[model samples]
Target chain A: MSEDKLLEVKNLRISFPTTRDRIEVVKGISFDLGREKLGIVGESGSGKSLTGRSILKLIRAPGQVTADKLSFKNIDLLAQNEKQMRNIRGTKISMIMQDPKFSLNPVMTIGAQISESLNAHNKLSKSEVNQRVIDMLNDVKINDPERVVKLYPHEVSGGMGQRIMIAMMLIPQPDLLIADEPTSSLDVSVQAQVLNVIDDLISKKGMGLILISHDLVLTSRYCDRILVMKSGEIVEECKASELANAKHPYTRGLLAAIPSLNETRDELPTLNRLQKEPI
Target chain B: MNAIELNELDIFYGDTQITDNISFDIKQGESFALVGESGSGKSTILKAIMGLAPKWNGSIKVNNVARSHGIDYDFAAQCQMVFQDPYGSLHPRKTVDATLSEPLTIHRISDQNERIEQVMQSVGLDLSFRFRYPHQLSGGQRQRVVIARALILEPKILLLDEPTSALDVSVQAEILNLFKKLRKERGLTYLMVTHNLPVVSFLCDRLAVIKAGKLVEVTGVEQLRQGNFKHAYTQELYAASGGVIS
Candidate 1:
C-alpha cells in the first residue's frame, strides 16, 4: 500500500453459492483509495454495489468474499473477528444505502437511532449524546432537529429520511464512508443538498469516500476519481475532470448515453454492445 | 382545440392539498413535459387528469370535452397512461395478452383480437412475448408491454410518468424511439412527467417546471435547444441531474 492510501484491495473476488453452481459476481479486481472520493459506475448487475458491500464484510453466508489484500488504514479487514469487525463497522467505516425507508428502523425515533451509534462507539453521557445527535442532524441541514428527532422514520419524507440516515452514519466519525446509490432515490432538487452535506463532511474530516452509482455525470461531479465497470470488470479509470476526455470506448459510450440538453441530436447515442466494449 | 386544458386545478389526497391552482394547455399532437422534484405534485397533476385523484377542484378539458371526476367511459378511449416502474405497473400473474386486453374488455370493445395484435405491433413487441407473464420478461420488454397496453385503446393523448427512468440507458433509447415513432404515426399528444431534463429535451416540444406544487416556469423546446433557461430553479435542477448538455 502507498503511504497516503486509506484502503487497498487486491484480487478481490466475491461469489454466491446457488443450488447449481457458485456464480462469481466480482472477478479479481484491485484498487486503491486515498483520502479522496472515488466513484464506481456501472449498470444494475455490474457488481459495483457488491464490491462496496464486500469491503465491509456486509455480504452474507450464501455469498463468499475473498481477497488477497483488503486493508483499511493498515488493518486487515478479512482477519478481523466478528466482535472486532463490529467495532470497526461504523466507527472506522460507515455505509449509507440507496433508500432510507428500508435501512432505518421503523419503531425507533430518529434521535435514538442516530445516538445509538454514538452510544456504542463512545462512553458519552445522556446529555452529550443528545447534543451530538442534534448537532449532526442540523449539520445535514435538517430544519427543526428537535421536532424531527422525535418523529419516527415513517413520519418524515424520503429526503429527510435520507438526511437522518446520513447523520446516523456520520455520527460515529468514520474515517471511511462507502455510499452505494445514496441519492438515487432522491429527487433532483434534494439530491444536490444531500450530496453537498456528505461532501462537506468528507472535506472536513478528510475521510476516504467511495461513491457507487450508475449515474456517470453525478459521480464525476462528486468524486475525485472514477472507475467505470462493465460485466464485473473495471473498464476505465480516470480523474474526475478527465472523464470527458476518456479514451476508452466504454467510457465514451457511457458519456454518449446521456441525453444532451442542447437538443442537437434527434436521438441520444446508444452503446454498440455488439462490438465488445474495449477493455 | 388544444389536446389538454386544466383550468386552475386543485388536487387533493383526502384532506391534504397536493397541487393548487395548476393550469396548463397542451396543443394537439404536442409533447409537453412536467418536470419537478419528487412530491412536487407533478405526478399528482397527471393523476388529476386521469381521474385517479377524484378529489380535485376545477375543470379538466380534453380535446374540448370536459371530464367528470369519475370513471368516464368515453374519456377512457381518448386517453391512457404509462407509469414509471414497469415491474410494479404490470400485473405479475397476467400474461401480456391479458394485460393488454383488460382495458378493451372494460370498454366492451368487441374486436379484441385485432386490436391486441395492432397495439403489440405498434409498440414493436415480439409476438413470442404475448403469452409470457410480466415476471418472465426483461425490464425493457415489460415497459414495452405497458406502452402497448396504453396504445391498445388507440388513445389520442398518452400520459407518461417517468416511463424510462426505471430502465437501462440502451433500453431507454429503444423505448424513447418507440414513443417518438408512435407519436408521429398515431398523431398522439403526450403529457409526460419526469425529473430528467434531458429526456424532456429529446421527447417534448415544451416543458413546465414545477416547484412546491406550483408552476414555476414554462419554456419552449427552443430554450432547451439554446441550452439556456431563464429560471434559477430550472437551471439548478438541470445542473443537478448530471448537467447533461447544459
Candidate 2:
C-alpha cells in the first residue's frame, strides 16, 4: 500500500454456492486506487458489480468474499467486525446502485430516508440534520429541495430519483463512493446531466470515486483511469485519454464495438468469443 | 402515400394530457426517428400509434389505413414492434424457436417453418440458437432473437423502442448493422423511438424532436449529418448527447 492510495484491494476472490456446484466469480483480482476517479469496465456477469459490492461487505450468505489485503484510507476492511463495517458502510464509504426503484425504499419519503441515513451515523440535532439534508439535496442540483423532500420514491422520475439517491448518499459525506451502472437506466440526454452532477460533487469534495459500467466510451470520457476487466481479472489498465489507442485486444475489441457517428462499415466488428483467449 | 401519418394527435392518461397537438408523417421505406429525454413523452407517441395508449384524440394512419384504439388484425399483419430489453421482452421459459413461431401462429400464417427460418437468417441469427432458452443466450443473441420475432410476421412497418439502449456497445453495433441490412433487403418503414442522437444519425433518414410532449422540429438526417439542427431544443439535445458544434 502507498501513501496516496485511498483504496487498496489485493487478490480478492468471491464465490457462490449452488445446489450442485460452487461457482467462482471474482478470481484473485488486485487493484490500487488514488484519490482520483477510477472506472471498472466489464460486461454483465463479469464480476464487476460483485467486486464493488464486496468492498462494503454487501455480499451476504450463499456468496463468500475473501481477500489478501483490503484497506480503505489506512483502515483494514476485512478485519473490521459487523459493527465497524456498519459504521463505515454509509459514513466512510457508500454505494449508489444501478436502479433507483430497487435501491430506494418505495414506501419511504425521500427526506425520511436521507434523515434515517444521517441519524444512523451522526449525533446531530433534528434541525441540524434537516438542514444538512436540504443542503445536500441542493448540492445535487435539485431545485426546490423542500418540495421534493416530501415526494415518495415512485412519484419521482428516473433522473430525479437518481438525483435524490445521490443526495442521500452524499448527505453522510462519505470519503468514497461506488456507483454501479448509475446512469444506464437514464435517457441519453439525462445521462450527461446526472453524470455532471456526480462529477461536480467528486471534484468539490475531493472524494475517491469508483464507477462501474459497461460503456467503454462513457468510462473513457468520465474517469481519470480505466480498468478493463475480463473473467474477474484486469486485462488492461490505461489513462482515460489513452483508451482510443488501447493496446490489449479485449480493450480494442470493446472500443471497436462502439458505432461511430461517422460509421462507414456495413457491419461493425463484433468480438468473437474464441478470440477472448484467457486475458 | 406516406408509410405512417399522425395529424393533430393528443394523448391523455385519464384526464391528464401526455402529448399535445403532435403531427408527423413518414414516407414509405424511410427510417424515421422520434428523439426526446425520458418523461418527455417519446414512448407515449409510439404506444399511441400501436394503440396501447387508447385514450387519445387524433388520427393515426399507417400505410394509408386509419387506426382506431384497438387491436386490428390487418394492422398486426402490416406492422410490428420490437421492444428495448431483450431479457424482459423474451419469455424465460420459452425457447427461441417457440418465441419466433408464436406470432406466426397468432396470425394463422401458413408456411411457418420457412417463414421462421427466413427471418432467423435475415437477422443474422444462426439456426443453432433457435432451441436455446433466453437465459442460455447472451445479451446480443437475445436481442437478435427479439428482432427475428419482430420480422417473423414480415411486417412492412417496424416500431422499435430504444432497441439498442439495453445492449452492450459491441452488441449494439451488431444489432445496428442487422437493422441496416434488414431495412435494405425488405424496404421496411421504421418508426424508431430513441433518445440516442448518434443512433438516429446512423439509421434514420429524418427525425422528429419532442420536448415536454410537443413536436419541436422535424429535420432531415442531412441536417444532423452537417450538425445543422435549427431548433434550440434540438441543438440542446444534440449537445447533451455529446455532439459538439463544430
Candidate 3:
C-alpha cells in the first residue's frame, strides 16, 4: 500500500463449482497498478473478463472468488460487506461493459439514465445534475449533447452508444476503470475513436485503467504494461514497447500469429497448445 | 464467365432503401471483399445475392445464370453462404452430421455418406465432433462446421459474411488459413464481407469500400499493403487501423 499504487491484487483466484469438481479459472494471479493503464490479454475462457468482474465483487454465488489481499487505496475490498461494496462501486471503481446496447437502460432517456448514475452517489439539485450530464456527454465527444440527451438508447448508433456508456461510467469520476473488451463489439474505425476518448479521459483524471482484451496488438498500443494471461496464469508481463520482442514462447507465438498489415506469409503460424506449459 | 455479377443493384427493406445502385463482379476463382462499418448495408448486399433480401432491383447473375426474386434451388447448388455468428446460424438442436447432410439431401446429391465425411476432414474437424450438437462444440469448431456445409455442395462460389469475426484472434488465424487452403484446393470464388482491413489484405485480391450504401473505391490488396488508398474515406479507414505497411 504505497501512495502511487492505486490498486493491489495478490493471489486472486476465481473458480466455479461443477457437478463433480471445482475448476479454477483464475489461478492466483497478482498485479499492482498505479494511475496508469494495465492490460490483461487472453482468449475466451482465459479468465480475462473474470479478472475484471472479480475486482468489482460482481461474481455471484456458485461462482467463487478468493484472494489473499485485494485492496484499493488502503481499503480492503475483500473485507467489504454488500452495502459497503455498493458505496465503493460507482464512485471508486466503475466498469464499462463490452456492449452499450445491453448495458444501457432501454426505457429511460439517455439523460435520465446518466443522471441516475450521478444521482445515486451524489446529492445534487436537478439543474446541477442536468448540467453535469450535458458536460459529461460533451467530454466523451458526443455531438449535440442537448438533442442526444432526449433520445433513448436504441436511437443512437453503436459507437455513440458506447460513448454514452463511457460518459455514464466516468460521470461518477471513479478512481479506477475496468473496460472489458470495450471496443471488440465496435468496428475498427470506431474502435480507435473510442479508445482515444478513453485515453484522453484517463490521463486528464489521472486514474488507473485495467483494459482486458483478446487482441495482442490493441493492448500493446493502449496500455503502459501488458500481462499475457493463459488458462488462469500470467504467462508473461512486459512493457508495451517490448511486446514485439517478448521472450515467452506463448507470447512469441501470439505475436507471430497476428496477421500483419502487409502480410506476405503463405500461412500464418498457429499457437501450439502443448507449448503452453501447465502452471 | 464471372462467378458472380451485380449490375445496378438496389435493395430495400420495405420502402426504406438499404443499398443504392451498386455494381461489382468477381472473376472465377477470385477472392473479393466488401469492407464497411456495421449498418452500412454490406451484409445486405450479400443477402441480396443469396436471395435473402427479396426486394432488390436489377440483375444478379451467378455463373452467367440470371437470378430470380424468389428462392432458386439451382442457384443454391451453385453458390453457398457462411454467416458471421456460428452460434446463431446453426440449428441448436441438430447434430453436426444432420446439419451437413441436410444440404446434400436438399440438392439430391448422391454419395451422401462420403460427402459428409470428406467435407468434415477438409475443414479440419475431427470425426469425434460429427455427432455433437452446436452447444457441444467450440466457436471455432462450429464455424468449421458452417464452412463445411458451405463446401459440401461443391459449389464454385462462397459468400462469407464476416466469417471469423466471432472467434478469438488465434482461432481467427486458423480459420483464415482454412479459408486459404479451401480456396486453393477447390479453386473457389470468395465474396467475403469484413470490416477488418488487415484480414482483407491477407485474404482478398480486390476490395470494395462501401460507405452509407454507396461504393467508394474498388482497389487491389496491393494498394492496401502499401497503404496508398486513393479515396479519402478509404484512407481514413486505413488510418484508423494503424497504417503500418512494414
Candidate 4:
C-alpha cells in the first residue's frame, strides 16, 4: 500500500437481513483514496450512501458489513469497536448528511452545536472555542458569525443552515469528509456557494473527500475520479474528465438523460427502468 | 385566446403580504415557468389559483372568466395541479385505483372504468399497478401516478411545482418526455414552478424569475439558452445551475 493512501477498501460487502434471506445492498467493491476528492454517483437504491456509511461502521443491527480488507491510514476499520468507532467518527472521518434541516439540533444554538463537536476531539478554553467556531463559520462564508452563533437552526435560512452543518463537520478537522448529497436540499445558487466553500476548505486542509450524490455533472465537476454504482455493484469507474465518454451503457444513458441548458432534442432519452437501466 | 391571466396579484397570509403586483399571461397551449428559490412565493401563486390561499387581492382569469374569491369547481376541472413531492402528495393508504377514481367520482363523470384505465395507460403505468399501493411504487412511478391523477380530470391547464426534482436523472428524463408527449397530444397549457434552469429550458417556452415574492425578470427560453438575461439575479441563478449549454 502507498503511503499517500488515506483509505483502502478491498472487496467490501454490506448486507441486511430480510424474512427469507439476507439481501446484499453493497456487493463486493474495492477502491483506494488519497487526499483527493472522489465522487460516488448513483441512483436511490444504488448503495452509494451505504458504502460511505459502512466505512465509518454506521450500519446498525440486522445489517452486516464485511470486507477482505478495509483500512484508514493503515488502521483496521473493521476491527474497531463501537467506542473506538465513535472516536474515529466526527474526528477522523466526519460525515455531512443530506438535509441540514434534519441533521442539526433545532433546540441548540448554532455556535453551541459546532463548539460541541470541536470540544469532543480537542481540549480548548471556552473563549478559544468561541473564536474557533466564529472563524470556522467565516470559513464557510457565513457573514457576521457572532450573531449567527447565537441563533437557532430554525432562525437561519436553508443555505445558512447547510453552511452551519459544514462548519460543524470541519471544526473537528477530520482527515476525510463523507458528504452525502450535501447541497441537494439547497437552491441552485446556494448549491454552488456551499460546494465552493467545501472545495476551498478541502484544498486548504488537504483532506480526502468522498462526495456521494445522484448528479453526474455535478460530481464530475468536483471530483478527480468518479465511481458509478448501479444496484449493489460498481458499473463504471473512470476519470472525471472522461465521464462524457463513459464505457458503461448505464453511464452513457445517464449522461444522455440530463437535458442541457440549450437542449435542442425534441425528446430526452430515457433509460428503461424495467430492463434494469443497463441499456 | 389567453388560457390563464394574473393581474397585479398580491397574496397575504394573516397580515403578511407574500407576493406584490405579480402579473403574467399564459397563452393557449403555452408552457410557462416560474423560477426562483424556495421562499420566493412561486408555489404560493399556484396555491392562490387553486383556492388553497384564499386571502389574496388580484384579478385571476382562466379562459377569459374572472375568478371569484372561493372554491371554483368549474375552475378545478379547467386547471389541475401536480405537487412537488410525489411521496407526500400520494396517500399511503389509498391504492392507485382509489386515488384516480376519487376525482372522477367527485366530478360525477360517467364511464369511470374506461376513464381510469385510459388515464393509467396515458401515464405509461400498466394495469398491474392499479391495485398496488403507493409504498409498492418507486418515486418515478408515484410521480407518474400523480400526473395521471391530475390528467384524469381532463383539465385544460396544469400547475406543476418542481414535479421531477425528487426523482432520479433517468426517471426525470422519462417524466419530462411524458410531459412533452402529453402537451403535444392534448394541447395543454402548463404553469410550472422550478428552480432547475435546464428543466425549464426543456419544458417551458418562457420563464419568470422571482426573488422574495417579486418578479425580477421575464424572459424567453431562447434567451435563457443563449445566457442573455437582463437581470443580475437571473444570471446568477443560471450560473449556479452549472450552465452546460451543449
Q: Which regions of candidate 1 are displaced past 4 Å?
A: A272-279, B110-118, B242-246
DockQ per candidate, 2 decimals: 0.49, 0.51, 0.59, 0.65
- Work out candidate 3's RMSD over C-alphas: 2.1
Q: Once superposed on the true structure, which residue ranges of model 3 sit more than 4 Å away at CA? A: A273-279, B244-246
**Could you give the CAPRI-style class of model 4?**
medium
> What is the Cα-based lDDT of residue A256 in candidate 4?
95
Please provide, for model 1 over B72-105, each residue's C-alpha lDDT reduced to its tens digit, 9 standing for 90 to 100: 7899899999999999998789999999999989
Error of 2 at A271 (Å): 1.3
The candidate, 1 or 3, that scores higher on DockQ is 3
| DockQ value for model 2 | 0.51
A28: Cα error in model 1, Å: 1.5
Candidate 3, residues A188-232, lDDT tens digits: the string is: 999999999999999999999999999889889999999999999
Q: Candidate 4: misplaced stretches above 4 Å? A: A275-279, B244-246
lDDT of 4 by residue, B32-54 (tens): 99999999999999999888889
The candidate that achieves the highest DockQ relative to the unseen native structure: 4
Worst 10 residues of 1 chain B by lDDT: B237-246
Worst 10 residues of 4 chain B by lDDT: B237-246
Each model's total of backbone clashes: 0, 0, 0, 0
